[model samples]
Target: MFHVALTGLLTGLALIVAVGAQNAFLLRQGIRGEQVLPIVLTCLLSDVVAITAGVAGLGIVLERWPSVLPVAQVLGGLYLIAFGIHAAMRAWKPTALTTEGGASLTVGKAIVLTLALTWLNPHFYLDAVLMLGTVANSFGEDRWWFLSGTLLASLLWFFGLGYGARLLRGLFARPSAWRVLDSGIAVLMGVLGVGLLAH
Candidate 1:
C-alpha cells in the first residue's frame, strides 16, 4: 500500500510539473496577490474531480470515444490560442499603475478562467484521467490508496503554487515585471496550443 501510494504521488507530481496555462495563471495570480484562495481552491477541486473520474473508469470510457477526443482537442487548442492572444495584447499594451489597489478582475472571472484553462485542454484528460487511471488500475485492490496519494499531490501542488507567488508580489509591482510575466504566459499558451494542434 505504501509503495502504491508513493508511486501514485510521484506520478501525479511528475505529470503536473510541466509548465502549462493553468500553472502560468496560478503563478501570475500569486504574483498579483489577487483571488489567490479561490483560484487555488477551484484548481484543487477540479483536479480532485478529474482524478476521481479517472479512478472510476471514466478515463477508459472517454478513451474509447475516438470522435470526442478530436473535438475536445480542437476546442482546447482554440481556447488556448485565444487566451494567448489576449495575454499577448495585454503585454503589448502598457498600463499605468494605480495606487487604488489593482484593477478589479473579480474572483468569479478567476475561477472561470482557471477552470477553462485547466479543463479545456484535452491533454489534461490524457494525463490526469487516462494515464493516471490506467496506472492506478494496475494496483488492483490498492487502487484507492494510489488515488489518495495522487489527490494529496494535487492538493499540495495547487496550494503551493497559489500561495507561493504571493511571496513575489513586491517584485511584480513593477509594470515591466508584469509585461514580462504576461509575455511569458502568452508564449507558453501559444506553444502549448500549437503542440496540441500538431498532435
Candidate 2:
C-alpha cells in the first residue's frame, strides 16, 4: 500500500505540477486573493473525477484499442505546443501583476473559467484521463491505491498552490520573475510537446 501510494503521489506530482492553464490561473488567483475557495475546490474536484475516471477504465480502453492512443498523443502534442506558444508570448510581453488593477472576476466567472480551463483543454484529457490511467494500470490490483496517491498529489498541489501562493506574492510583484517563470513554462511545455510528437 505504501508503495502504491508513494508511486501515486510521485507520479501524480510528475503530471500535475506542470505549466498549464489551470495551474497558471490558480496561481494568479492565489496571488490576488480572489474567489479562492470555489476555484480551489473546483480544481481539486476536477482532478479527482478525472484521475478516478482514468484509473477506473480508460486504461483498458487504451489497451484494447491501441490505435486510439496515437490519436490522443498527436492531439495532446499539438495542444501542448500551442499552450507553450501562448506562455512564450506572455513571457515576451508580460504585464505587471498588480493586485489593485487586475480584473476582479465574479464568482460565477471564476468558476466558469476554472471549468473551461480544466475541461476544454485536450491536454488535460491526455494527462488526467489517458496518461495517468495508463500509468495506474501498471499497478494491477493496487491501481486503486495508486489512484488514491495520485489523487492526494493533486489535492496537495491545488491547496498548496491556492494557499501558498501568498508567500510568493512579494516575489511575483516584479515583472521579471513572472517573465522568467513563464519562459520556463514555455520551455517545459515545448519540450514535452516535441517529445510526444517524436515518440
Candidate 3:
C-alpha cells in the first residue's frame, strides 16, 4: 500500500509539476496576493473532478470517441491565444505591486477564469484523466490508495504553489518585474496555444 500510494503521489507530481498555463496563472495570482484562496480551491477541485472521473472510466469514453480531443484542442488553443493577448496588453502597460495592493480582480471573475483555464486545457484531461486514471487502475484493489496518493499530491502542490508565490511578492514590487512576468506569461500562452492548435 505504501508503495502504491508513493507511486501515485510521485506520478501525480511528475505529471502536474510541468510548467504550464494553469501553473503560470496560479503563480501570478499568488505573487500578487489576489484571490489566492478561491483560485487555489478551484484548481484543487478541478483536479479532483478530473482525476476521479478518469478513475471512474471517463478516460475510456474519451478514447473510444477520439474526436472529442480535437474539438478541445481547437477551443483551448483559441482561448489560450486570447488569454495571451490580454497578458501582452497588461505587459505593455505594466504596473507595480505594492504592499498596499496592485491590480484587483473580483473573486467571481477570478474563479470563472480559473475554471475556464482548467477545463479548457486539453492537456489537463490527457494527464489527469487519461494517464493518471490508467495508472491508478493498474493497481487493481489498491486503486483507491493510489487515488488517495494522487489527491494528496494535488493538495500539497496547489497549496504550496499558491502560498509559495507570496515569497516573491517583494521581488515583484517593481513595475519592471511585472513587465517581465507578464511578458513571459504572454509568450508561454502563445506557444502553448499554437502547440495545441497544431496538434
Candidate 4:
C-alpha cells in the first residue's frame, strides 16, 4: 500500500504540474490574494470528485468510445485559444498586481471561473479522469491507495500554490512582472490550443 500510494503521489504530481488553464488562473488569483480560499477549495474539491469519478470507472467509457476525445479536443482547443488571447491582452496592458491587496474578484465570479478553468479543459479529463483512472484501476484492490495519493497531491499543490503565492508578492507587484507572466501564459495557451486542435 505504501509503495502504491507513493507511486500514485509521484505520478499525480507529474500530471498536475502540466501547463494548463488551471495553473495559470491559480497563479493569477494567488498573486492577487482574492478569494484564494474559495478558489483553492473549489479546485481541490473538483479535482477530488473528478479523480474519484475516474477511479469509479469513467475511464472505461472514454477508452471504449475514442471519438469523445476528439470532440473534447476541438472544444477545449478553441476555448484555450480565446483564453490565450485574453491573457495576451492583459499582458499588453501590464497592470501592477499586489498579493496583499488589489482588485479582488467576487466569490461567485471566482467560483465560476475556477470551474470553467478546471472542467472546461479537455486536458483535465484526459489526464485527471482518463489517464489517472486507468492507472489506478491497474492496481486492482490497491487502487484506493493510488486514489489517496492523488488526493494528497492535489491538496498539497492547491494549498501550496494558493497560500505560497504571498512569497512572490514583491515580484508580482510590478506591472512589468505581470506583463511577462501573462505573456508566457498567453503563448503557452495559444500553442497548446493549436496543438490540441491539430492533433
Question: What is the lDDT, from 0 to 100, of the residue 167 in candidate 1?
Answer: 83
Best by TM-score: 3
Best-matching candidate per lDDT: 3
> How many backbone clashes can be found in candidate 1?
0
What would the per-residue lDDT of candidate 1 be over residues 1-199, giving only the tens digit for each residue?
A: 8999999899999998778999998887777777889999988898889888998898889878867778878888989999999888877776623112345569899999999998899988888899998999888889999999999899899889888877887877788887888889899999888877877
My TM-score estimates for the predictions, one after another, are 0.93, 0.72, 0.96, 0.92
Ranking by TM-score: 3, 1, 4, 2
Q: Which runs of model 3 end up more than 4 angstroms from their true locations?
A: 96-102
Looking at model 2, the pairs that clash are: none
Cα lDDT tens digits, model 4, 1-199, are: 9999998899999999766788878888787777899989999999899899999999889889989888888887888898899878877763433344334579998998788778777888888899999999999999999999999999999999888887887898777787888889899889988988998
Q: List candidate 1 stretches off by more than 4 Å.
A: 96-103
For model 1, give the RMSD to the true fold.
1.8
Give the number of colliding residue pairs in candidate 2: 0
Model 4, C-alpha of 18: deviation from truth (Å): 2.5
Q: Kindly list the per-residue Cα lDDT of model 3 for residues 118-156, writing each as its tens digit.
A: 899999999999999999988888988898899999999
What Cα-based lDDT does every candidate model obtain?
0.85, 0.79, 0.89, 0.85
- Two-way lDDT contest, 3 vs 4, winner: 3
- Count clashing residue pairs per candidate: 0, 0, 0, 0
Write out the backbone clash pairs for model 3: none
What tens digits encode model 2's per-residue C-alpha lDDT throughout 1-199? 8998999999999988976767877887787688988999999899889889889887567557767656756766777678779768877864533543444779999998788667755567778888889888888899999999998999899999999988987887787777776787688768877876876
